[model samples]
Target: MSYVDGYVLPVPKSNIEKYREIATKAGKIWREHGALEYRECVADDVKSGEVTSFPQAVKLKDDETVIFSYIVFESRQHRDEVNAKVMSDPRLNDMMDPKSMPFDGKRMFWGGFSPIVEL
Candidate 1:
């Protein structure tokens, strides 16, 4: 099964363009390091849930929107190897710095997953 790294974050509406620019560059870097696929999506119709939801998870604000993204890898080990390289790339230096981020890093979250079923 393919391994995947997924992300959810809250980005201010005013910073969507900036966020997209950053994500595009980051996606390219991840792919160059051997990720199978990289995808990023903004919330269109997602509504806050009573208990839990994308917006709730990110503590989304009225002036912000939710972003959902993911990267596919060959396996867990492959994901790790690719991430190590991506993290060390000098091109991502500013990105590696928390203060330059388009969104609040403290509110962002991500995790690696092992696919259970795929057809």
Candidate 2:
């Protein structure tokens, strides 16, 4: 089974371009470190639900939009190895600082998952 790392964050509309630039660089680094796939997607038609939603999950504001991203690896062990290299990569040093991010790092959420099914 494949292992995945997923992320959800709210980015201010004004910072979308900056966010995209960072994501592009990070995605390249992740892939170079052995990630099979890296994708970053911005919200298009998502809406807030009464009970729960992408917007609610990230505590989105009117000036912000949700970004959903994921990185795919061959397996859990593969993911760990790739991530270890990624964290130590010099190219990502500038992006490692939370204070420099365009979004609120405090509200961002991420998790690793084992895919149940893929068809």
Candidate 3:
């Protein structure tokens, strides 16, 4: 089994390019640090639900779009190790500041998962 970290956030539509630039750099860093896979996806057809949905989950606005991202690791231990290195990496300094992020930090949500099935 593998461990995964997933995230959902709302980014300003105008900042999509900026967000992609940042994610690209981050994915490369994670891969270098041993992440099995790193993926970032933008919403193409997500819609608000009556009770809950990607848009509602991130309090998405008309000028914003949802970003769904994930990083996969060999295991929880590996994830922790990779994340520790990532956090300490000087290349991530600018990205460490919440105020300087491309999206609202308060609105983003993330969690670690234990895969229940692989095939």
Candidate 4:
């Protein structure tokens, strides 16, 4: 089964373009290092639900939107290997510093998940 890493974050609407640029660069680096798929999606029709919703999960406000993304790998071992290389690659290392990140790193949440089914 394929391994996956999912991410959710809050980004300022005013910085969507800049965020997209950064994501594009990072996505390219990940792809080059062996990620099978890298995708990013911004909130389009998201709205507040009576119970809970994506916006609520990230405490999104009027000026902010959510960025949902994921990276696909052949397997957990492959993901580990690729991430190690990606982390050490000079072209990507500089972006690891939260202070220099294009988006609010503190507002980002991510996790690795074991696929239960794929069909």
- For model 3, residues 1-119, the per-residue Cα lDDT tens digits are 99999999999999999999999998999999999999999999898999999999998999999999999999999999999999888998997788889899899999999999898
The worst-scoring run of ten residues by lDDT in candidate 4 lies at 93-102
Candidate 4 colliding pairs:
none
**Weakest 10 consecutive residues of candidate 1 by summed lDDT:** 94-103
For all candidates in order, the CA lDDT equals 0.94, 0.96, 0.95, 0.89
Q: Model 4: per-residue lDDT, tens digit, 40-97?
A: 9999998889898888888887899999999999999999999999888898767678
lDDT for model 4: 0.89
The deviation in Å at residue 30 for candidate 1 is 0.6
Q: Top lDDT: which candidate number? A: 2
Error of 3 at 101 (Å): 1.3
Off by over 4 Å in 3: none
Q: What TM-score quantifies how close candidate 3 is to the native fold?
A: 0.97
- Taking the tens digit of each residue's C-alpha lDDT, what string does model 2 give over 21-93? 9999999999988999999999999999999999999999999999999999999999999999999999999
How far residue 38's Cα lies from its native spot in candidate 3, in Å, is 0.2
RMSD of 3: 0.7
Candidate 1 accuracy as lDDT:
0.94
In candidate 1, position 86 carries an lDDT of 95
Better of 3 and 4 by TM-score: 3
Which of 1 and 3 is the better model by lDDT? 3
Candidate 1 structure quality by residue, lDDT tens digits, 2-106? 999999999999999999998999999999999999999999999999999988999999999999999999999999999999989999998768888889989
